[model samples]
Target: MTVGEVMSKDPVSIREDDYMTHARQVIRDNFLRVLPVVDEGNRVLGVLSDQDVLNIRSSKSNVTVRGYIRETPLITPDMDLLRAARELLDAKQHHAPVVSSSLDRSIVGILSDVDLLRHIQPTKRSPASVEEIMTAKVETAYPDDSISRIWDNMLHWDYTGIPVVSHKKEPMGIVTRIDIIKAGYARIGTANMHGRSSGGSMRVEKVMSTPLYSVAPESSISEAIGEILRNDIGRISVTDGGRLVGIADRHDLLRACLEGTGL
Candidate 1:
């Protein structure tokens, strides 16, 4: 299969000159992981991810997309699906703009890890367990922790999601970047930047995704993938006897698939 077969065509994009506030709204409204940054002629520039938008302090900020635009591999629609996944992984980005050709940078579509996941199958090689690829040293947030504190932790550690745990370390829920963004609390750590006192008062439990989905350490990679796709979540908790042991995300599963298939 090819990238064009799975990629989202005519993706929502922002002009390089657009303000970060607009970019934040576009991403929040569309639930986009990344927004393609384009020129006036619709040529691809780069992309602004949800993480980038977290840097915005107020809804009235005048920062342009150009400064925050992150360079990503430009994918062509004709590229092999697996190969495109590999390139995106290597670039450490979940989304990439798809152009017609190398010489023509005009974006015709957009590709994402989720797009690739829909077409991926369990590797033909020996199946691996989720434990083999999960990130064990997870940073978690307590339910009582202030959103401001959690937000600071997420930015300081570059974490997409942090599991909210109980005093005993049992997973209760997960707070993610989108969760904060969707709740209109993307400000990295400026609780008083715009006098948004409520932003600092909010608790992790209020913004966290509940009924946390999880997989056992011994579960197959395919099982973990199924849980993620089924729940439409970025990652799942890896638990053993109801205790959080690790976390497995799309990148981990994608890597395992590529390595196992030797793609």
Candidate 2:
């Protein structure tokens, strides 16, 4: 399939002159990996990933998106699916702004890893287990752990989600960057009044998402993909006999796809 066949058209985008506060809110609310930055003429300038917004500090001033705009592999609607996916992977970008052409920067659509994963069936090429692609060295959080601590860990390690485990090391819930961006964005005096403060007093259990989504380490890569797509989540916990083992995310799945299909 071609990129145009699966790419999301008229994707959510932000103007170059828009404030970072607004950009951060848009990413938080849309659950987007990257937001296209465009000019007044609707020409693509670049993109702002979730990581970029996570760096936004809750200070007295707000910055415009222009300064934070990042360059990404420019994708065109007519490009091959795998080729486009390769460009994204090569550039270390999860998504990119689809343009009319290399010369014409007019934004056309947006293509993400999720969009391509739906078309490429890795099972058809190679029957690899989730364990082969999962990140074994996983990071986790305890329910009793302070939200402040978890937030610091996520920023330090650049983790989008951290599994919340019980004292017995069993998965209980999950805490994600979005969770912190919502529950802990405010660290000033007003955060105390809002009750969602990221201060040491707030516990991870309070902000962590319950009913953890997980799959067995030995599960097929196809099964892992299904779970991720079903939940519309970035990553899923990998367990072994009810114990937290690893993590399988879109990046891992797509990397496996490229290797398996030799795309």
The lDDT values for all models are 0.83, 0.81
Model 1 weakest 10-residue run by lDDT: 188-197
lDDT digits (tens) for residues 134-249 of candidate 1: 99998889997877777777766767889999999888999987787778766544543223445457777878989779999999988988899999998889999889999988
What's the residue-level lDDT of 130 in candidate 2?
89
Please give each candidate's TM-score. Answer: 0.90, 0.88
Model 1 segments more than 4 A misplaced: 187-200
lDDT of 2 at 166: 94
lDDT of 2 by residue, 1-263 (tens): 89989988888999998998888778877867689999999999999877767566663446888899889897998899888988988888778889999899999999988898888777466547889888898888999887767766776777778999999898898998777667654243335313544445678887889878999878988888899899878898898888888898888888778775566
Best by lDDT: 1
Query: Which residue pairs in candidate 1 collide?
Result: none
